[model samples]
Target: MQKFFAVVAFAAAFLTAWTAAPDRAEAAASRIKDLAAIEGVRENQLIGYGLVVGLNGTGDSLNNAPFTKQSLQAMMERMGVNTRGANMRTANVAAVMVTANLPPFATQGTRVDVNVSALGDAKSLQGGTLLVTPLLGADGEAYAIAQGALSVGGFVAKGDAASITRGVPTAARIANGALVEREIAFKLGTMSTVRLALRNPDFTTSRRIAMAINDLLGAPAAEPIAPSTVRLSLPPKFNGNIVDLITDIEQLAVEPDLPAKVVIDEATGIIVMGQDVRVSTVAIAQGNLTVTVTEQPEVSQPNPLSQGETVVVPRTQVTVNDDSKKKLAVVKSTVSLRELVDGLNALGVGPRDLITILQAIKAAGALQAEIEVM
Candidate 1:
């Protein structure tokens, strides 16, 4: 009997893997770095206020958008050109915000890509050249200088009574347009110890990561700092060679743990369950009930000699109907995903109906997974 039960369980598992996760059934060992990242070694955001010029009458209106006019006047004043009384109403300039990411270990004169976005009611930023803009970090310190011709992937044009547009003409990216002016002093390799922060916090995964790192070096060099972090002490042999140590650690593969979950998109009538999801023995009854109400109007007129006024009356019709093909099914506790799904299908429910059934099962404490409603 035990041998027969084992074979049934194996078959159920095989069917579940083959059908549910058709393309990806195998849970292979993933790289340690793919599931975690080193703390404090990240990118920094840089922002700057700049202007995009040379627009073909699609730039911000200086009259309605006084800020654009004021910005232009201030820039001209900085260049020693006195335009205090000049009323600039041309659509050849636009106020924009320049942004870039200062990568860790970046040095002076290193080029980084920048994103330009119009800050005003400009129709578009196409064919515009960004002025000399200094990108600032969170500390309000200038870290990079961005200046180049904008490469707008979209365009907009309005003629007489019609207009044509595509993509987003108000935003653009310039490849290698910003020069790094300051380096963020990140002493990544000089630390006596480094910490790995897990992308997902799990006690089991954290313990496994520590075990994997220790197993690689044949010593207890790593310790679990938290459920989401692991700290490792640099060995004396690896002193001043932190990069080599990190590379080895990243290459080491470990099976990352995933939580059992069922996601339901009620708007699209889509239901998805994780491989580890299960349901206890339960009975489900499902049927559809619909109620429809409609309105009807009628007009009545009396004979002219009778001296009776014409009248209009309103009537409403309502009907209630229940599906006659209701189904009631008993689901047995299944240790395999295939059996669980097969039992649910026996109820003859669609995706939308399955969402309600799953929710009901969760409320009844039969579903052994988290149900995420989206």
Candidate 2:
């Protein structure tokens, strides 16, 4: 009877241990659109120097910004007014720098929004109009031209000895203010092969992606060139147009490897940990120490006949409180993420406390992944 009781106890322990282990399928997750990226698609930045007119006496002062004066002089010359070396003071115009992004494969005559910022000491750009300005590319070539009325989302009001200014005083934007004049040269169908670059490169993820592509379209269709790049042969049908091929390839699903990582935002005290994070058996003790100082003022009056001066004295009181006698919590080796979270949560640690704990864990060679703080 004693042997049978011992055997039953052992069996129960074994079953409990087996059930405690986390299921691999439930823990395994492939981030949505995490490993996929478009081939040969990108955005180009376009910039231009322009002027914003129609300001209500809040334009750039010509004395401070000489560039604004020079620009205005040059613009006046084009209109048959030769103002060379002329000291002109105008409060209706403000110098602005215009910027816009040209999307990939943007056709001619397509309109895009442009951002305008005051480059001088303009108090406000409200109700200003941006003149015709030629937008230039990185290669010093004109790509688009911007011209529209400014839509400053702010206002300023002034009265005698008082003024109220609200919103941004230097920046504004114009909707559909730029027109594309040229197309970026990008050949997508000329090559018989194309490369797919992963947004986040992982060896395991790259292998899985290559395998999935090969399985979908035989082994001869796709090959893994490196851990981050996969080369694919263009099918005869897609050789004429590559857009359809990209659309189909991006929809293919593949299981991705979860990276062990811990991210902390120091500004907001946010801590994020991956599911694969594990912790070794360690003891953690947390306590608070506070020191407070207070001051009390006292006044002493002069005696009536002693000719003594009145004086004020300040008294400071200081106190220190330490809570180091709290119980130290011990956590055993955690094999899974849920266990690690549960153990940490049981210690009543907040986000800031968790950040410290993670840093300490990483320093002790227990955390297996990279720690990033932003």
Model 2, span 97-198: residue lDDT tens:
999999988999999899999999989998899999999999989999999988887788889999988888678988999999999988875667777788
Report lDDT (CA) for all predictions. 0.86, 0.79
Least well predicted 10-residue stretch by lDDT in candidate 1 = 1-10
Candidate 1 lDDT score at position 278: 83
Give candidate 2 misplaced runs (Cα > 4 Å): 1-34, 157-165, 237-240
Cα lDDT tens digits for candidate 1, 1-374? 35433543464566665766544514556889898999888999999999999999889999888888998999999999989997677899999988899998899999999999999989999899999999999999999999999999998878899999999999999999999999999887778788899998888888889999999998888899898999988877786677778988998878777789998877766666777898888888999899999989889899879999889888889999998677668887865677676776666666667778899999999999999998
**Which candidate comes out best when scored by lDDT?**
1
TM for every model, in the order presented, reads 0.86, 0.86
